[model samples]
Target chain A: MNGPIIDITDLSKFYGKARGIEHINLEIGEGEIFGFIGPNGAGKSTTIRILMNMIFPTGGSARIMGMDVIRDTKKIKTQVGYIPSDASAYSSMDVHEFLSYCIRFYQIQNGEQRISDLSELFELDLNRQIADLSLGNRKKVSIVQSLLHNPKLLILDEPTTGLDPLMQSVFFDLLRSENKNGMTIFFSSHILSEVQMLCKRVAIIKEGKIIQLEDIDNMRKKQLKKVSVELADHVNIKSFSIHGIENVITGPGNMLSFMYSGNINDLVGFLSGKEIINLMIEEPSLDEIFLHYYRS
Target chain B: MNKNLFLKEIRRNSVSLMIWMIVITLLIVVTMSFYRTFLENQSKIVGMLSLIPKGALQFKGISNFNDLMSVLGFYAANNVIYMMVLGSIFSIVLSSNILLKEEYDKTAEYLLTRPVTRSEIFISKLAVLSINVFILNLVTALAGFICMELVMKTPFSIGAFLILSIYTLLLNILFGAIGLFLSTLIKRAKPITTFSIGLVLIFYFIYTLSKITEGAAKMGYLSPFRFASVDATNPAYTIDLWHLAYFIGISLFLTGLSYRLYKRKDIYT
Candidate 1:
């Protein structure tokens, strides 16, 4: 309540000789949509699992709302909502039964009303058996269950995996509304675009370590771009070297490609004298950004 | 223990408990039904039984032919396999899966994420295991009682019958503890059903082998079944203090150890 809503310090987890997350530290403020992005096996889920206390960290500490994640797990969980990466629930239980069971874990009044409201929003049939539901429907049931208690903090791990694009829109809208109501969100995913679309601040993880932590605006305004030009005449590759030019490479024929993180006008002015036959400038993929960070 | 988790686990295990109860009760009833035929041809049956090896008779837990003549002895010898071995199997299987199933089924993420501690989860599932084992034993013991009453030519000692039933219950509970301990030690989430059931059978086999082989009689001490006295016809038969301590002590030790291990276990799903 006083400092960050979630604070992780020098946290590390190891499974025998394999690394889970190593000496990682993070802080998420209240009422903020925080994104944790990483590729598969990059320890995104490992960090989240430690925060949720689903697994113990081999070292370091984590706290939620100023309480220890391990020692005060029950107290912390009362106000924390989590949607796991997997949409697996008890297959033997019907959707309504599973939702009801989950709601009883808290002392919330009007539990049925909340379940119905969330289920309706997700277009979930409460009576359908979980085993009978498609993967998408099961994910819907999972989403509805996480929101039934109206938690103060919501932690999602690849929460939109099986949902259709339309459903994903609804889910994101609901998340935005929840955040507006002062609920903090920790959204973890491999999809950078989705993280870009929702998160205010983000931490990019790779090889079990945090590689970058920055405001989403700063990340976007860093001025990284993919530029490719096919010259009408063969030009010296050395001439393409400008202030922001990086990873410059020559292709078949007279094509020159590189990444630019400098002023746009400077790149245009430099390329003007080259007699370019074709030019393409687009946003770099997340992988390229990640590679750049790793290389640098 | 959390009430919500306790109630849900009870509901989840009710069907399996009912099926086990029915199967054991039916086995007891069918076995007890043969009592009248055995009584009618007592001499011929005794002579035929005499021709069987002494070791084989001891394996069936028949110390003497006269023990078989008594209805309670007949039931105890025959039904130990059902109520002790099978019931222990059921108890171990139920206990082993109650917590681990949440992991293997991938529902632990949902359950463990709730406002409940790992201790509460372990205690809740243990409560369900204890209650289920109790209910199964009570139901089948009652069925055994009824079958014995219907077939008994003479009144048997009530105290001896009760002691026998307690032994069976203790044996079942010990297996339940073993299962819980085994489950906690598993680093990965997978059903130990076959391994749990096999442990019970292997213990029973040890008990049987110990009974028949003179040189191996001491080996039965390694099995929990050896501590459970099934001789229902002994006039002084009562619950043994050491056996009671063995069952209660080992169960509590295992259950406590499991709770500690589970509290710190890195549940992976």
Candidate 2:
């Protein structure tokens, strides 16, 4: 890798006596949509907070674009756009006023165009007060504010939460465009399908530890498939046993279900030799992969 | 960055500022009007002043209507105490929102992710609070002076009132800094506000107790409110510059402490 956009080394955080996160080490490449997948209370938010420098770590350090998160927070913050898990703005302010206020703070020149672009992209109404906005609309405002400055990096925690499916797709499309423009997008989500659809690579976290980190394509290749077959009459299911077959489920009237890993050539050959009436092959969903990680 | 943040703070606290202005103006007007009515009853007013403690009577210098207006000016100066306390409360609540509100509103993650240092953010907020305190004291003093002129119809020393106003502004800044310090230490707003009010009351009570007891009079130095002494006619009414220095020193110290704590503190939900 040329240089990771984000380099976290053994970053740990503690809430009083309770462990928030521990020994978390990761490096995210530039222009990569790295999905941080973890369930609630799995330390995803804690890690994001540390990276943002909104909270100090109990031990270790995090860096963005090679700058220390603590010592160089101001420089780091200018380059990054963040959408928190729970998106909220000042309730007393109207959407336009709030965005304008943030724009002033960021000191962005020609900020009007940026505001217009974001408001249009996110389908946000700038005239409405923040208190009057629904959770989903408020989330849209958060998204607009993050992207308005055209940051080089976007750290979004559960960015799609509270968004309707249509708006979620819109947000995904926006992220895709930003990624294409070479913005490093790092986000966490418990919604595996969203990760599967949007991320080229993912790190699965469980109990505050990274359980797996792999390319989505590589993960798909490693997936196991279940093949079920029904024969014309009762038969010995053991006769169909083949190499690379993990297990087999046999039922009355020659019904057989085989769980196969790796390539299924041998099992397919055996099935072709048998008098199979009907057959079905099922690929495990993302939910199963998540459940498998938790169970293990 | 400082200018932008200061303007934003002004905008945020505009409502409280307006409320303070209206309430303070009306209070000055009503008090001045009542003093005018009491001045018409000169014998009765003098009789009441005679009943006060000899020290307070001598300090007020009330022998005529002009002196009576000066006495009322001394009492009106007490409004500065109320303004300082209220302004400090507002500044603390507002400045605290600059950081803690980000956490409460779940915006800290977004804000910190921006290219800005915690120090810069903190300094900007402190500047805003200072400017707010200055404006508040200026407005209160001007309104009080206008009300006094309208009611008393007498020429007063602008220099004396201006000096008193500067002292009042400094006192407001001191309290404002204290409020900012408490905000950084406490997470929630309700508890912080309640605690701050209680602390101010305790300080005031302590100062009052010191006033009533000769041996314990030294304890008044501990109160932030004790530094304001507008009755400059009596030599004893002259404020100790060392005490003023201590007040400013403590305010600056608290502000520094708040900045240090906020910079390193881990924000949690």
Candidate 3:
């Protein structure tokens, strides 16, 4: 119980000769939101499926709550709540009926109350058949079903793919509340902002391999920030190098933009002495961070 | 654990149950009515009826109709062959829906995430199909007996009826297993259904071909339908113990194989 809730060690999966995931190792602690960031076909979902025990790993092992995933899949599944990227329910069943069916499979008490709460939270209509609901609404139903059992661990793949902005915030709030109650959440998202906001630590994946796994704050500190200064007239761009800046770009001899990867104070003093009209500083987006990591 | 899941399956397949019931009842009524009219010409009909093979006559389980209409009425009643076919078709219809529905609705991922193991889920669904098949055969047998009584006024030995019912149930299990096996192999519902129907037709045709050709008679052994005695005159209307054993054995084997394959196969698109 003192160890991480999820421990994946040297995990690998292959589809025929092609590698699905390779030498993947990570640990997610209780009460932590671990973001798995990757683009399409980056093995994010594959790793999650292995954790969920939907399939076995080709090499290595994964343990959840001190239980081997493959050996104790039944015990593991009961304690984990999973929201698949393309969640679907029986088309013939209405929302309430579908939830009722799922509830019978678990040992949860007071399932009715949980279902009611989730319906209210997601603003889902209980009477509508699943086929009648829109894609986003179906995703909401999936979320509700996964949460209804009050699982100890949550594995969600692309959890916010189909949600509007307001609903996405609601989902994040729900996840935050669960994390506060000591649930371990391991989610994959292409949305960097969501990961930045929800997760304390993240693992960036590319082409079936982990490119980087670090604390969010540390990642932000390590990644470069861009600073752009609108110049009054053409001047020597090399002067910007005084701030320990690199990759400077001058457009039409009036604008100077360069990537800053060092201390902010150096740039502040260097800019204070220049004849600048306006200055803007912003951090690089998640894509840029991933791109940089990927390139390296 | 299995009992509750079995009941749920019966509820899901109630539509098919009702249809089979209606068809079996109508067959009983029509056959009895026709036999009654034929019996009116007693001299001509009795001679012709006697000439028919005893096995074929026993297959219908109809004897001298005290109420001629009633005797003929149950002629179609004990047609266990027809009942078995209906049971097999229903089994396929119900079992084929098991996996494909989850995949079609995109609920496999959600269902797989539950605390239950893949083997447990597979077995649960198989258990449901088995129970449904058993109930279906039981209902058909009981209803057929009742129709026979209403039409013929003749009583049947409970033992003989029970044996026949057991045979039909075994036949259902065999076909249901085939359906379940196909569900795992195929990803779509339509192909599985069509292939199941094709299998039924092929087995039936093989059974008939065995009867017509000298070397082909053994071919009947290959069909689950052939294991159940459609002709009651041979006193072998009861299912052969070996055949019953084989049916159950194959069913379990196929189900186990499917579970193993599904456990390792990659699911995500």
| Highest-scoring model, TM-score | 1
Score residue A209 of candidate 2 by CA lDDT.
Answer: 77
Give, for candidate 1 chain A, the lowest lDDT window spanning 10 residues. A287-296
**TM-score for the B chain of model 3:** 0.78
Runs of candidate 1 with Cα error greater than 4 angstroms are A226-235, A251-257, A263-286
**Stretches of model 2 off by over 4 angstroms after superposition:** A105-110, A222-291, A294-296, B46-81, B84-98, B153-159, B187-191, B213-219
Using lDDT as the measure, the top candidate is 1
Position A248, candidate 1: lDDT: 90
Is 1 or 3 the stronger prediction by lDDT? Answer: 1
- The candidates' DockQ values read 0.86, 0.51, 0.47
Runs in model 3 deviating more than 4 A are A106-109, A222-290, B2-10, B27-33, B38-78, B153-161, B186-191, B213-215, B235-238, B259-269
Tens digits of per-residue lDDT, candidate 1, B4-103, equal 9899888888888889999999999999999999999999999999898797676665788999999998998889656999999999999889889989
Best by DockQ: 1
Q: Write the per-residue lDDT of candidate 3 for residues B1-269, one digit (tens) a residue.
A: 34444455556667766786678657655654555455567678657777865434433444443312333223433466677777788788677777666666567787777776667667777777776777777776776666556654455555556776777787788888788777777633243667787788788777756655657768777877767654333234455779778888998898788888777655553
Per-candidate TM-scores read 0.96, 0.83, 0.82
lDDT of 1 at B21: 90
